[model samples]
Target: MLQLEQFEVRERKLQFIKEYDVEKIHQAKLIVDTDISSSVSLIELAHMVGLNDFKLKKGFKEIYGTTVYNYLYELRMQEAKKRLLNSSQPYYLMI
Candidate 1:
């Protein structure tokens, strides 16, 4: 029962995000920073987007040119890269 309600909230949030879609390259930061945990099911994004898993899966690939999961994965990697590349290392590691 609780899970079902949570699904509705997640769908609402996902719809808002999709409708407002812009150049995701620049906006990836915003997406990464946004608190989607409250609204969207991180477990299965297509369900949150209100599509059958396969259709949402294929549509994302066609429209966005990448799977949603892959896009999210890349965003996390980019963030990690930024942190790793920008931070100063320990003196021992640097040497």
Candidate 2:
């Protein structure tokens, strides 16, 4: 019974978050993942998603389990690793 009550509390907390907030967070992630070369500022991205910077940061971290800056860094590193492994030419020759 105690566990069920705690689960209900968590569910209520999630319900308190507006649907738009979830949509905006998804938009931010899509933009970041699909356009890796984009140099848009965090404020600009937040505005594009119709959110303020603070809410954007909070919602993004809550949903993705990491900050936006860290997410971008990880994606970039993965991309670099992929290219290095899949490059047609030898790594030494490219240097």
Clashes of each: 1, 0
Q: What is the lDDT of residue 29 in candidate 2?
A: 92
The candidate 2 region of ten consecutive residues with least summed lDDT is 7-16
lDDT for model 1 comes to 0.52
What's the C-alpha lDDT at position 76 in model 1?
65
List where candidate 2 sits over 4 angstroms from the true fold.
1-13, 90-95
RMSD of each: 14.1, 4.3
Give the per-residue lDDT of model 2 (tens digit) for 1-95.
99788767666665767888989989999999998878888999999899999988988876676888899989988988898899998878865
Candidate 1 C-alpha lDDT tens digits along 1-95: 99788767666545644543323322432443463233344334443444455655544554455765676677667866776787798545743
Instruction: State the displacement of the C-alpha of residue 69, model 2, in Å, after optimal TM-score superposition.
Output: 1.0
> Whole-model Cα lDDT per candidate?
0.52, 0.85
